[model samples]
Target: MVDWIIFLPACFALNMACGPSNLLAMTHGAKCGVPFAQKAAIARLIVFVPMIAASALGLGLLLTASPFVFGIAKAIGAAYLIWLGIALWRSAKTLKSEEFLDKSVSMKIAFRTEALLAISNPKAILTFAAFFPQFVILDAYWQSYAMLGAAFLIMEAIAIFAYALGGSVASTFAADKIPVFQRISGAMMCVFGTLLLMAS
Candidate 1:
């Protein structure tokens, strides 16, 4: 059986790879004077949990059917990351006041965006497939799988919360210099994307 302890670090790494957008989103909400903690918590519970569950199950089945499919998915994900990285990096150059507008974004929109982002990430899907079954004993499907999935979800929630809190703290420092900070954060996101693509 796979050691449960190892899954925590794996989940953390996966979150670190895909967490920039979530951090940025929460920071944007915070800038608009929205309560980021509550919104972030809600986003995880209402959106991330279900998405992770469905994606895990679906990807698990897909990998069982054809392992090669994951390679293609990883390539696609890498390409998408590169594209996103470039866009974020470019936005860093053209920082504008309107970009940080306090416009109200609905919970539904936040939930949907997060869900789509998490689902489309090949790293996330691959992680679920590769790591989840490690804990599952040959015949003890229910116990092991449930524990693994639950551990992933809990780790994800904690990591997201940490990211949001970090964003909030960063925002406080950049309150008066929003544009500059946006550019810096955007550049950081680009770096993250580049790393993800290279790793893939």
Candidate 2:
């Protein structure tokens, strides 16, 4: 049996972490709107489900054992994040001249960005592999893991909503200063990329 008391809080904490993906959610929410961001954020869960399944099936451990593979994954992720940061920074200039956000941001673009960001982050898989096992029961391994995965997805959805709401609220207040918000988000993304690169 899974320990709901402990696992719920811990899992929620992990979901609520101010990670790249969550930051991206906030950025999207500010740029587009909460409803648009929430819809796009579903792509994260789509990617995570297979990742969690893979972790449960033990491929996460195999990948972890291979430093070469892990390094490649981390490098790709860091590079993508840095590139995204730079792109956003450059785009901030264009946003400043306009009173409204570029409504040109389509659902497809947002969906793809969310999906790629989630997929590129190797830590997502590692998180599932490392964190889920602690709460899983050996005797009912599959059942317990399934339950944990469901719980994680639920908590993740809530976290996504919370972050999106926060961004939405901020954007509402800073309606006249959207460009400044974009610049800050862009800088944070760059910092996150650099930190990910430096991580052991």
Model number with the top lDDT: 2
Model 1 vs. true fold: TM: 0.68
What is candidate 2's lDDT per residue for 1-200, written digit by digit as tens?
Answer: 78999999988999999988999898888777788889999999999999999999999887788888888888989998988988888888876524445556889988999999999988797889889999999999999999999999999999999898888888788877877777877788898888988888
Model 2 misplaced regions, further than 4 Å: 97-102
- Runs off by more than 4 Å, candidate 1: 1-6, 9-22, 25-58, 61-68, 82-109, 195-200
Q: lDDT at 32 for candidate 2?
A: 75
Q: In order, what lDDT does every prediction score?
A: 0.58, 0.87
Give the lowest summed-lDDT range of ten residues in model 2: 95-104
Per-residue lDDT, model 2, residue 179, is 78
Minimum summed lDDT over a 10-residue window in model 1 is located at 29-38
1-200, model 1: which lDDT tens digit per residue?
Answer: 65757767866676555455555555554444335544544554455455446544565557536747756655565565556556655764765545554445455655654554555556555566666666666577656666677776676666666666665566566655666666665666566556655663
Q: Model 2 residue 145 lDDT?
A: 92
After superposition on all CA atoms, how large is the RMSD of candidate 2?
Answer: 1.3
TM-score for predicted model 2 compared with the true structure: 0.96
